[model samples]
Target chain A: MIEARGLTKRYGDLVAVNDVSFEVGSGEVVGFLGPNGAGKTTTMRILTGFVPATDGTAKIAGHDIFEDPLAARRAIGYLPETPPLYPEMDVAHYLTYVARLKDVPRGRRKGAVDRAMERCGLADVRRRVIGSLSKGYRQRVGLAQAIVHDPAVLILDEPTVGLDPIQIREIRGLIAGLADSQEGGTGHTVILSTHILAEVEAICRRVMLINAGRKVLDGPLAELTRDGQRLEDVFTRVTLSDQAEASAGGTAEAAEAAQ
Target chain B: MRHVGAIAGRELRSMFVSPVAYAILTLFAIVAGFFFLASVLGFDAQVAEAQQFRAFDYLRQLNLNDHVIAPFYGIMWIVLLFLVPGITMGLFASEKTNGTQELLMTSPITIWELVIGKFLAASLFVLLLVGMVGIFTGILFFFGDPELPKAASGLLGLTLVALSYVAVGSFASSVTRNQLIAFFLSLVLLLILWMLSIVADLGAGGGAIASDGLVSRSMRWLSSADRFEQMVRGLVDTKDLAYFGFMIGTFLILTKASIESVRWR
Candidate 1:
């Protein structure tokens, strides 16, 4: 449902994301694993149409994100690194506003907001102001807004970050429930970006590991630990290998440019 | 455009809920009321002086449009220059600061649509402010006779001026995440535009070439104050109308570009 081809993003001389590519199938729960500044968020942002890739193409639900952004955006439910919320708006109103922005038909706008609220367990505090809500509730509101439009693909960046254990569990269950419910229907495609190995184990079946803006490994979770090596062991090995390789590569390029 | 409406509604709702909107409204009302009352009293004193001199011709000079409404509109224009930056300082800056810009940018709504929606929402709030101040004008209807069409035209001119202020302010806000920076940037730009015509006339460059010197003429054409003065005279010239339309459209396009450029960065 989501595909990226040779995606790269640069800020002036700083290459934020190097040539990278990945895909997520419909109804599949994929974990995007990367270290800090590993271009995980940039990749997700490209897929969600938040930022244009410096080079390469990203398509969401078969629509080119750059060429046909509106259609592509319509298929994506994105929870950015920070939840985009107006502090003064209450939870219910915020959802409704997002519903409207997502082009939820006027007749179905109310229903969509209500359903999203219920699914995210935000119904009890629907009337409460978002600014005053706890971090957990705010995260849930962010999740609720993303799914409010009923997009086919969900791109969440650190959805469970900063939450307490219970809140984290609830959010995880909510994500798992989304996939399970997909089994009986057309299903949803989820690409969750996180550094937590446990989060990947909890809900994600497939893991796409990235290092230094490069896709170092992508496979089913089962295959990654086939030789009795733990996921953490695999993560450290793949990421550190790139860290070493990147530094070596950087020096060579610098020497070549100097010469 | 339902997309535009949805964005506008949400923006206006957010603004009204914030204390900033109330602060601007209350402060504007107090300043405007003081000026309006002063204008009215000045007109009254002039009328008394004319009557004591038994000069019927002097009464003509006390026309409400000129003596009272015109100056009141001028005061409101200056008030807008100060007050309007508050309305737009947070338009795009807050979104960027609070990280909501990502959500907004990722949404299906186009950049132009978002800019237009924000500009319109701020314009609507300014309209509401003018409508509140129009209450003082209502006093004219009750106790005295003010030319209705002229008064209405002055209000239209004020709205246009406010729209221009909002247009500039919106563009300024799009360039930064700090509201104070946005406010000052807009204030400086508006001040420059406001003073251009006067500055031109005061210099040798103004009249050195001809009465229609390029520097002075161009400055006058760009000066919102100059156009608004013509509008208060109840002369709706197409050139004046086009000046405002072009000013607003230009700034809105720049604002859209400023926002689209963020994705690149």
Candidate 2:
């Protein structure tokens, strides 16, 4: 469902996302693990068509992002690091607008919106203004937005980052449910980025670890943890390798540029 | 067009749902009303003086169109010039600051569609501002015998002026995430465009603008204020329309290009 070939991004002399590539098959949930400046969000942004790759190709369900961005983007449901939401807009109105932007048919919009809200557990706060909601509720709204159009692929960046423990668990269960066809949320190939190793352990079936813009590891989660080794020791053993130089600069630029 | 409508509706909803739409409308109406009242009082005083001195030449030529409507439209033109930047400053900048630009850009829409959608929303709001001018003119049709077409033409010109500023404001807003920066950038650009015609007429650039050399004529041709003044005189020249059309089209294209260039960076 997602294919990336030598995707790279550069700013001035800094290569924020180097020539890195990987592919995720349909309906597979992959965890993108990286440190503070591991180019995690940058890669996700490239895949979601939020940021253009400086070199090479990205395709969503066989549609090249650069060649036919709208089509490629249409198949994607993205939740950026910060939930892209309007503060003054209520939950239902905001979701409806996202539905329209994602090209849900006029007649089915209400149904799609209702299903997304129900899926995200946002029904209780449907009429509440987004700004007035707590962080967890806002995160759910962002998730609801991503799935509103029922896009085939979901690219979520740190969806559970700022939520409380219970909120995190709920969000994880929602994601896990989406990944499991038996849970009724079907056929969503998700690529979620996070620094939380336990998050990958909880929901993601595959692990793709990137460090300093290069993919250091990619494999089945079960195989990597087959020896009962803690994912933390493995992550530390790999990422703590000599590739940890000058990573902080990109984080600064990331916040500055995204703003 | 569907994409454009969706984006525009989102923008319009954001404006109206907050205090933004009401604030802009009420402020525009109050300021425009004061300008109308001032112009009416000035015209009445001028007419009374003319009649006292039996100045027939001045009186014969001095109708409401000349004394009241033209100056009223000019004041409205300047007022909108200041107000338009405020309306458009947050159109794109707020999206960036709030991170909504990420969602907007990632969605299935082209930059041209985004720009046009924003331009349409700003134009629609300015259309309401022009409607306020029409409401003020409603009182004129009652007691005064103003030339209907002439007054109507002035309002049309005001609308075009506001729209042209909208295009410029859209471009300005697209360039930055800071609302204050967007506001000042557009205000300065509009002021430059407003002053260009006066500067083009000085020194060796005198006589009719068309009779001048290419450089002087081009500056005059590019001067929106000059064309807007012509429209207020009840003259709807195709040249004026073409100038506004060309300017609006250019600025909107530039607005799209500015946003598109962000991906490259």
Candidate 3:
């Protein structure tokens, strides 16, 4: 399970994530939806312990992200806003290195590396240098590194951001399969952040909509968009309504001043 | 410790896999070898002439002792200045630039583990460089009488100097995502430290007023040149050892703190 309470991140005068709180239970796939600069990435960083919260707490698998970060980190796997990779390393070497660094038992290290490669469809390109790989293959290598240790929670930020349509579908399928597969199962709780609404509707059971650094909506995907409404319609309504209200309020102030 | 080893192994492998490592090794070999060969030839000529003269003049001509040793340290320092930055500039800079820092940061490892691991990896490369120098030093032994103690002390000094440089380089790399910036920063910081003793000497000579008189004195203590001089002279002063240890420790701690502060950003 992953839990966050009053999580906040501020950069100088800008509040990136303000008082955000949520939880995801085991066997849950939660989609984090937001427009550009909506603090989705910021929140994911905090949960993974990549960035610390300004004035709040986050726990992963019962371990506090700040108080016991290593423990919390041990329970989670993360792919950041951009997939982290060492371009000079070959695919097999990179995954094996990550597997060892993730503390896969020495005896199981080889097997873990192999499993991550096979699962990510990187077996064919195992010998290829990562610097020479295509974007899609690199993304898969990034995913392979994340799941090498098979942690209880997976936090992927824009996992499908730059992939071709076919690669996107394949990655989405991989995520879904990993979330449900028995051998790969840790009842793995996944928090996937993306702006692509269709992917969310297809992969996420629960959804959270964030706007301007705050959560504006949170619930199941189906219930959040009832009446057979498209996910995009609900998203537009939530975000655009805020923009329209601000504009209308500005106009009202101007009219009053003219009067 | 296992985590540190894991990171070190990966870093070491990456160093070998990339052309940068080979480039550094080749450059170091050429530069270090030329300097060593030149010094040995010069010393051998002087020794041959001294042998033809009286035994008393032989003692006077042995003044070349410092000259021969100075070149070894000089060339080693130059090689280290160029090569340490290459090994370390990309350690954290590439991680941040390429976004792998996020993955490593989120892993189940402490900041200390990361710092030490990276430092060790860079240090291992330095060790390899030092080892090659040792091979050339061995070749010197094949010629005329070589001062084994002085040679060993010089190697020791080189190792400590490399450790200090790697620590500072790692810290510099951690503060930025640009490898070029990291390299320049490390070089500039090292240059400042390298020149500190000269600046202090000038201050003491009234060339410039010491703004912070105590700082100038401490700067002398921090001088890599001063430490290496003592080490090359075969004096293993605990205080000098402590200074290098302190330098490496200070930078490693800075690296850890710098990485931790990113969490707040």
Candidate 4:
């Protein structure tokens, strides 16, 4: 479970994320859609406790992210846009280090790493150095690290960005299985951020569209689209209209402030 | 703490695997060996001259601490000043450059744990270098009558100085993602701190007592080499110990603050 209220991040005068708020129930697979600079990554970073929000409160499974960062961080398994890997380290060694970082008990570290590797389909290349792996394998390693600790919430930023179509399908299926099979098992709340709309259709249960650091649409995937209007059409209409309005409003505010 | 150990263990492994570790070790050994041999030959030359005047008493009068080991330790410290930056430049800078800092920042580990872990790992590399150079010192036991207490104190002093270097170098790395910039920043900071005593001495030109004023005294007290000199003299003054401890703690805190600033930024 995750909750964010009035989240705002300002880098000097530029507002990277402004008054953004969202929520997801336990075990929900939510897709976060946004244009380049739509504050998706910023919001995720704040939630993961990697960056501080200028104003707002975020609670991760009941622990406040800002006030109780260690506990909140302990509940989050975050995979940033980059895989965050050491090139010289082998896959298993890297995962074991992550297990230690996530505070997996000594007795269960190997089991946790093994299960993560198994779930991510990375057992065959366990001994191979991460640098020697292909991009697809590297991405799988990123996914394995995120699930190594079995955290309550998983925030994956563009999990399928560089993978091929087959790899993408496999990752989507893996995510789908994680959401469905874990209904009675370990309930993992996943927030996936991606630019690809079709990927969301394939795996996400709910979609939230954001533009210019503001959430433009939030609802069930089916509810957001009309009887005949395609999702792409809706995405363009909402995002493009917001972009025009933002440019016009921004110029007016700047002129007024200068005067 | 266990968290510190886990982080430290990974850091040490990564360091050992890098080419930089081997390069630093080999370079330090070669340079240290050069200095050691030169000191021994220079001492041997002196002993030969003294034996002509007093053949029986000359060997007994040879002061191994002053003639050979002290100067060898001095050269070792200088070697460390250059090699230490290499060891520490990538500690935090490479992590940030490669984007692994995000994983570290989001983990349950605190900034202090990360800073201390990396610092301790760098210190361990310094220890390994000392251990390798210790083989050269061990040779003194067979041919010369070196004072064991003095030799032990000198190694302790060298370790303390290496730790101070690591602390500052870690802070330098934390402030920037560019390894070259980190290396130069640490080098410049160290040179300035070491040179302060020299500058103070120059200020008291022709004066017998260099500690003539508060500014000079403070500069001498702040000089890392000055404290090391005392330790080399087998005088482990509380003030000198406190100075090394304070230097290490101050730089570590500064490093933590820089990392925290990145999150806030």
Candidate 5:
């Protein structure tokens, strides 16, 4: 489980994450929906212990991310906005390296690599150099690396960005299969951030929407989309309400000044 | 330690597989080869011409202890100055350019592990390049009476210089995404240090007051060139070792700090 309270990240005078708080329990698939530069990536970074929060705390698997980063990180597998890859290495070599870095036991390294490659549909391209592979293949390689260690919490930032429709569908299927696999029974807890609302509606059980670094809404996807409301409509309504409130405050301040 | 080794191994493999590594190796070898050949040929010609004179023979007798290995130490310094930067220029710059830094920063590994891993990998590549030069220097054993201890000391000096260069190069790479900029930054910083020693030599020759000489002395103390010179003379001073160690530690810390700062922004 991952829990954050009053999480805030500030850059100089600008606030990237503003008093945002959320939680993801075990066996849950939560979608993080936010537009570009809406603090989605920053929040994810904080959760993964990649960056420290200016104020508040984040705990992963009952360990405070700041106080016990190694433990928290060991329990989480993160794929950032861009897939980290060494272009010079073949897919197999790269995956093996990541497995070792992720602390996969020596005896289980090959099995872990093979399982990751198969699950991510990268078995055929294992011997191919990552630089020679197309973007979709690279993305698959990234996915394979992320789950190679079999971390309980998987945080993926914009995993489906810049992929063809077929590739997207295949990746979505892979994530779904991973979440519903019978081996562990209770699927891995996943927190996927994306601007693609449709994919979230299609695959996510719960969704958290943030606009301008603040959480605007959070609930089960089915319940949030009830009353014949599309996910897009709900997103627009919530964001537009925030903008309206801000403008109304501005006008009220002007009126007070006039008085 | 395992995490650091894993990262270093991966980085070393990447260097071999990439075209840039081969390009750097080839360029350094070709340039250094020409420089070595010219210097050796020129010295041999001068020695042969001087051998014909009786006075020269007496001078040669007096200077029988003159070591031909000393000149090679100079050549090694030149080669290292030119080559080590290229090996390290892309260490962090390429990651930034390719946007892979984000991936690394988000990984479970600590900042120190990442920085030290990259530093060691780049240093190893520099050592490999120096090893090739060592093989070339080995040929001197067949041609003349070469001082083995001095030669080994020179190689040690080269390694220290290479380590210092890699640290600066890695720091430069961390500061920018552009490989060219990283290269230039490292080059400029090293050049300044090299020139400072020369300026200090001038100051010691009566250009500056003894009281104000501390700046020049400190600048000379920081220079890789001066340390290399001392090592080549068979003196492994603790101060020189400490200077290089401090340099390597400082840059690695800078790299770690830079990487950590990325998450905040």
Candidate 6:
């Protein structure tokens, strides 16, 4: 339900996202893997309508990001790298506000917030201010917000960042459930970016990798690492091969361009 | 719109959730209370002197609008100039600093909905300050006569000026992620806005709709403080109303442009 065609984002001479293109069909969970400064966040931002692409287009559930930003955004539930939380707001109240912004029906807003909290395992801390919560709970709150409206598409940027191993497992399980659950006889379409290679194996169905703003690899998770080959070696081979070639040729764009 | 209301409601609640709201309210209350008492006491001293001199006719002619309410309203405006920046600096800048702006940016709401919602919340918070002035004005009627129309018009003028302050402040906040920069930027802009209008007030000789010349006409257009001055004179001309509407609209558009520019950046 996500289509990105030649999505390029340039900040002056720096091409943050260079003509990157990919598509994730409905009920597919795609893991977006990239190193630091690889433009993964920028690509996600462009798709979620947080920022405009410099020279391309993206559509979420058939709604163009540029032409119909409101409707396009209506189909998306985005969790940015930082989780976009208000420290002073309590968990339940904050979710209700987000539900309102997402245009969840007034009668069902309470139910939506409750369900989100329930799904994220955030019931006991509903009245606790976000600032007072532990890192795991804060991450859970972030996850709760993404599913609060039950949107058709979920674009999460490093959803498990800064969480403990147990918390990470919980979040991964939650995402896995989102991908396969028969909540409405269909699962949510999700594209999550992460630095952890194991994260993809744990939850994601497919894998899309980008390096220096370009998609270097996009394929099924199993096929990409078949024959007992580990995912890390494959990830390094695809991402670092370009760097090795650029450095050997003494090209100025070797690694600084991404930074 | 419902979207606007939802955003505005959160803004208001968030403000109260933080300490800034109570601190600014207490600050306005203490400062405004002192100004009110000072004006009333000064008016009492004048009345006592007039009675001592047996200037009965002059005492009869003396009105509360000129000696008490008008000056109090002017002081209220000055108080607003300082406190308004506090109210608006966090409107957008705090969202950026805390990274909560992403939530709003990715939502289904339009840019206008976000800007107008924060603007509405800021105006409502400042209205409570105006409401405090109402209580002081009420006390004036308790012991003496202050023209009702004049008082009402002055409050309206105060509200209009506040709307303009909030508009400018929101614009200032949208341009920066630092709350300190936002606060000082809007403070300077509000001060400049107030000063330029006072210049127009001086040029027009503080008269009602002084359009005798092109210079005065332009001066009237620049007159933010002058509009309040006219309203204090119990004048609610269309010119003053139009000027405020223009100020609020211009800054609202500017704020929206600044936000949209950030998305492009």
Q: Judged by DockQ, which candidate is best?
A: 4
lDDT (10s digit) by residue, model 6, range A221-252:
99988978888999999888977865766655
Can you give the lDDT of residue B177 in candidate 6? 96
Off by over 4 Å in 4: A248-259, B53-61, B206-211
lDDT of each: 0.89, 0.90, 0.86, 0.89, 0.83, 0.90
TM-score of 6: 0.94
What is every candidate's C-alpha DockQ against the true complex, given to 2 decimals? Answer: 0.84, 0.73, 0.76, 0.87, 0.65, 0.83
Backbone clash pairs for candidate 2 read none
- Writing each residue's lDDT as its tens digit, candidate 3 over A1-259 gives 9888999888889999999999889979999999999999989988888777788998899999878888888888888867889888899888887887787888998898899899899999999999999999988998888889989899999999988999999999989987885764465789999999999988999999998888888899979778988899999999999778768999999999999
Question: Residue A132's C-alpha lDDT in candidate 3?
Answer: 96
**lDDT, residue B223, model 4:** 91
Regarding DockQ, does 3 or 5 come out ahead?
3
Q: Candidate 6: misplaced stretches above 4 Å?
A: A246-259, B197-220
- Could you report the Cα RMSD, in angstroms, for every candidate shown? 1.8, 5.1, 2.8, 2.1, 2.2, 3.7
lDDT of 4 by residue, A1-259 (tens): 8999999999999899999898999989999998999999999999998889999989999999978999999999999999999999999999999999999999999999999999999999999999999998998899888889999999999999989999988888877777765536856899999999999988887999888788988988878765777778888989999999989999999999999
lDDT score of residue A240 within candidate 1: 86
TM-score of 1: 0.96
Query: For model 5, how does the per-residue alpha-carbon lDDT over B218-242 read when each residue is reduced to its tens digit?
Result: 8677767777888877788898888
Q: DockQ (C-alpha) of model 3?
A: 0.76
> What's the CA error at residue B227 for candidate 4, in Å?
2.0
Candidate 5: stretches off by over 4 Å: A253-259, B56-67, B204-212
User: Model 2 chain B — which ten-residue stretch has the worst lDDT?
Assistant: B202-211
CA-based DockQ, model 1:
0.84
Per-residue lDDT of B87-115 in model 3, one digit per residue for the tens? 89999988888888877888787778889
**Candidate 2: true interface contacts recovered:** 0.91
What is the CAPRI rating of model 1's predicted complex?
high
- lDDT, candidate 6, at B206: 65
